[model samples]
Target: MRRAAIVGTGAIAAAHAESLRALGDRVELVAVADVDGERAAAFAKEWGVPRAHPGLAELLRAERLDLVHVCTPPRHHVPIALDCLAADVHVLVEKPPALSLSEVDLLVEAERASAGRVATVFQHRFGPAAIRLRRMAAEGVLGRSLVAKCDTLWYRGDAYFEVPWRGTWDSEGGGPTMGHGIHQFDLLLSILGPWSEIRALAARQARAVQTEDVSMALVTFADGTVASVVNSLLSPRETSELRFDFERATVEVEHLYGYTDAHWAITPAPGHDDVAASWREKPSGVVSGHRWQLAAVLDALDSGEPPPVTLADTRITMEFIAALYASAFTGTVVKAGDIGPDDPFYKSMEGAGAPWADAR
Candidate 1:
């Protein structure tokens, strides 16, 4: 059994612990760590973990872990992940793996120098609905993907940002665009492949934070498909939705956080009723969450292959985020390869400084 430990005793870390427990004999949750000593010890006791440490250094020195889940906030992801990789321990980090693409590049270099692999937690891609959609697209059953829409409109009050890191450029990165909508948009990118260019706008309309509360973008894929992307934390009636308009049918998934088969639907385009029927006939029952992704990570480690949501795949998503921020802040169309080493957005999402910085 692979020995696993989770750093960060937050709610997400508990989810990782539960997922590790669910894996039974395949993996073991050996330790828990947090910046707060009491919190880490409490979490260890609560999860039945044998060890608890105040920090990653203590945990690493105590146990020879096979895997480490970097469940900390975005700013700390790269440092902790690098340390784990240097110790030859595979790492699974939560979403928004790093604050910037440059930081991701550093982690990539670290991984190259180590025997371990790094993966980000994008559990939405593991759902059966997502799997079925991917298969349909691959099999040409969905026909030519033309237009798409991804909306991640969820409500977050001003109190949510009182934590000091909830909506900052340096800590949590961008607001809804980086934290909330990334899941939906990442799945969208997974379906549509490489994005070509983006023209976008971001605003701090409601919440009191250092970042934009809402962002909208028009994205063009390399294959000539276009998409409208919306990420918001100001919506009263929250929902996460994605729609892909193919020549044969329109496939959609509607869910708030996670989704099952019942949350998905397909509408046939006139004579393409077979497409709808085939979608229903396909196997589905999995709910997208940490558990599903953890199982896949364990399987990949067992087979000596990179885990799901590898850093290379996540870099595409991160690059798209960089492009979105660049387009929004600069009032210019940003392309896939446009945000290279010299771009400010590559170093920070604020892109030198947000246009509205003085106004705020």
Candidate 2:
């Protein structure tokens, strides 16, 4: 069995543990680590792990680990990933991969520097519903894709922001865009391909966070497709969904319970009367993305191949995120292919914890 170490004993760590445990004969959970040593120990005990460490380096240097699942908050991503890659250990980091494109580039350099792997955890792609959606779209079920509407409306109270880094830009990155809705945004882009431009508006409409709790953007894709993505942390009941409309067909899926499946619905528009027929097709999948994502990672490791979510794909998302910040700040449409290394916001994480009302 391939040995693995899970860094970060946060709430989300349980899901990762549960998923990894399910892969019984394939992977062995070697250790659990968190900044709070007690929390790490408790998590290890709860999951029946053999060891626990107070920090990532301690775990890495001590354990004979082949992989590290990074479940830490956004700010620690780059640092932890650098440490892991430097040690030549594979990594699967949680979403909203890093703070900046520059940070992502650094990780990419490390991955190249090592004989190991580094993949951002974008588990949504593994969801059966998502898998079918991508399959059908690529098979031409969606004739000429035109528009996509991706929405993430979930609520988080003050208690949710109790963590010091929860609502800050410097640590958690942007609010909903980078935090809660990042997976959904990444899924949408993964299905629709890359964007060419984005016009955006963001604000702290509902929460007292350092970034926009709600935001919307108009995006134009490289394939001449137009899309709109909206993210918010204000809904009473958490709902995450995506809709894609095409000239011949349309595909959509909704999850009432976060990225993991509570349910899914994918419709293939009919030949003549499309929308009507679409309503007739049934949806499938009722499992969380956690399991499939973990499985894919193990399989890739065994096969000596890269994980599905590539760093370049992640960089694409970050590049677009930079565009959103620019457009939101300057009140102008930001072109995607236009952002370059020379841009002022390129490495502008200095004072990053400031108001997210404007990043430009």
lDDT, each prediction: 0.92, 0.78
Error of 1 at 22 (Å): 1.2
TM-scores for candidates 1 onward, in order: 0.98, 0.91
lDDT digits (tens) for residues 1-360 of candidate 2 = 999989988988888899888998999898988999889888999999999998987898788889898998889988998898889888888877798777888888888888777788888878766776676668775577888888888888878888888877688767787777788888888888878899988878767667777878999998888888888888787888888888765666677544433355444455546543543456454474777888988888889889757788888888878778777766788887666667655664222233444543
Tens-place lDDT digits, model 1, residues 1-360: 999999998878988998999896899998888998898888998989998888999989999889999888888999999999989999999989999999999999999999989999999999988988999998999899999999998999888888877888989888888899999999999988999999999988977678999999999999899999999999999999999999999999899989999999899999999999899985677778999999999999999999989999999999999999999988999888988899889899888887778876
lDDT of 1: 0.92
Find the candidate with the highest TM-score and give its number: 1
Q: Candidate 1: count the clashes.
A: 0
Q: After TM-score superposition, what is the CA distance of residue 215 in candidate 1 from its true location, in Å? A: 0.2
- Show where candidate 2 strays beyond 4 Å: 258-262, 266-286, 348-360
